[model samples]
Target: MARIRANGVELEYETMGNPGDPAVLLIMGFAFQMTRWPEAFRRSLAEAGFHVIWFDNRDIGLSAEMGGLATYTLNDLAADAAGLLDALGIARAHIVGMSMGGMIAQLIALDHPRKVDKLVAMMTSSGAPNLPPPTQEALAALTAMPMQRTPEAIADIAVKAQHAIGSAPNLRNSAEVIRQNAIDDFRRSDRPFGVIRQFTAIQAQPRWHERLGSITRPTLVLHGADDPLVRPAAGEDIARRIPGARFKAFPGWGHDLADAMSETLANEITAFLKA
Candidate 1:
């Protein structure tokens, strides 16, 4: 676990593959640790001849905390990512983000275009008004908090949430895998207040949907047809608003990355970046 000071905070990060290879920076979603990025997915990208980097966003995992402050916005989050590249001496990189991370990635492409080679937004939204809202089940699952901070309690909440927003039964990871992931995350860092702070930051961010048209980077918008959280139309809206952006939606997929979808997602992303 490498921790480096970037932007204004210390970020826990890890890198894979040769340093000489083209870089791919993976930004995870709201309140998710970098470990949530599957090892197989990271390894696949590295094996495909790219240097992959992922880190715990500020206020999550082993990264620096912001106390009770919710003053930061998505743009600040975007800067954190760019600063990470600077710390690593990377001039530019292929930026891939999931959910809220996608929103931040869009900002990077818009506000720091020189630092992004290509952009991939997955299972995320443009925060456009009147966009389809999450289903009741997904909404409840996402908003639910573990009553106790114990690993079992936290893992149970995560398991239930995954079941609600994850891929179809046949396409999802085994129950054990999901539960263990949650447990691991909890054990690594159980900062519920930090999670709340991150959520508040998202709520405080200014809407940037209309700004999507300004992005000029080669972009790919990937989503799941069954995604109930952000919804497929939200992803489509991003692709539609961004000139020349390509969109792809997978059937039987949902909000979370499952083992069954890893290969397809990796292949799609690798092809786009190489192109």
Candidate 2:
């Protein structure tokens, strides 16, 4: 792990594979740390001959926090991503983002086109008003306040949320694995307020469908067919708006990226970047 000054904040980041290799920058979703990009998944990408970069976005993980701030937007987040690349001396990289990260990735390709070689927007929407909203259960799980901040309590809530929006019954992880991940994540950082701030940023972001057309980079849109959080229609709409962009959907997948889906996700991502 290392720290770099980006977008007026210190960002925590890690890199895998040889620096000489092509770079793949992985951005996580709302309130999620870079660690959410699974180790095994990162390894697979590295083995595929790419340098994988993972980092904690501002206000999350060991990165700087925005205390007492009222609001921020996705453009600010996009700038941060660009700033990180600048700090690391990477001229350009394949930008891969999940959920909110996808929104930021879209903005990066629009705002900093030269810095993004290829784009992968996964399990996210274009933030258009016409896009379908998340299901009640998924929304509730996302917005529900935790009863306690204890590791176990947070873990329980996390597990419940995962079940509410994760892969179909047969493709989900064992309870033990989910519990462990929750505990680990909680221990790393439990700042619910920061998460709320990130949520605020997402809410404040403008719809990107109008701007997406300007993204001329090779683009790939990935989503779960049954994702309750960000519906499949959102993914389709994104692909439809971006010229020459390809869309891929997993039949039974959901908002959560469990171990069961890692191989398929990594393989598809590798092929897209290579092509």
Candidate 3:
């Protein structure tokens, strides 16, 4: 795990593929560490000839955590992402982000347009809180879970996560992967408060509809048809607001990456970036 002291924090990161290739940065969702981007996913991306970068956001995984909440807006997170690229001496790169990471990526594409060659927003929204929130069961399942060490608790949480995603029954099963991921998360970092701080920045963000037109970068919006946390409407809204943005939705994929639908997601991204 290489570490870079950047963006006012020492970020822990990992890189894949040839350093000489053009890059794509993979930004993960809330409470997820840098490693949350599955190695297979990275390998698939690297195989596509893009140097993929994955890193822990501040207070995640091996990154430095000053405890207490950060006085940061979502825009601050975007700046931090740009700072990461600067630290790595990257002038421009494709940006792919999921959930909270997607939000940050959107801001980056909007704020530092020249730095982004292409943008992929997955399972995320554009601070458009007017859309319906997750269903009551999904909201309770997602927002109520605690990050802890107990196997039973983690198992239960995984079950809830599975239910919330509402994966199609015919799809490849992801139960084991999801459970293993939760276990890894518990072992890696348990700073649930970090998620709270990040949510603080996310929830307080104003709608970006008026500003979406400024994103001239080619953009792709990927959403889970069955996703409860972030509805497909969010993706539709983003795609509609951003001129020329392409949107794709997959059945049986929820917010979680455990879905077997990742190949489809990766393929779409590869095609988009190559275009």
* lDDT (C-alpha) at residue 164 in model 3: 66
- Off by more than 4 A, model 3: 147-151
What lDDT tens digits, residue by residue, belong to model 3 across residues 140-241?
A: 776766465586577668766666665665553466767777777777777677777776777777667679988999999998898888899988999998
Candidate 1 local lDDT, 30-65, one digit each (tens)? 989999988889999999999999999999999998
Model 3 has an lDDT value of 0.81
Q: What's the true lDDT of residue 101 in model 3?
A: 94
Cα error, residue 241 of model 2, in Å, equals 0.6
Ranking by lDDT: 1, 2, 3
State the lDDT at 11 in candidate 3: 84
Question: For model 1, what is the C-alpha lDDT against the true structure?
Answer: 0.93
Which residues of candidate 1, in runs, are more than 4 Å off? Answer: none
Error of 1 at 207 (Å): 0.7
**Counting only residues 3 or more apart in sequence or on different chains, how many pairs clash (N, Cα, C under 3 Å) in candidate 1?**
0
User: Looking at model 2, which ten-residue stretch has the lowest summed lDDT?
Assistant: 169-178
Instruction: Output the TM-score of candidate 1.
Output: 0.98
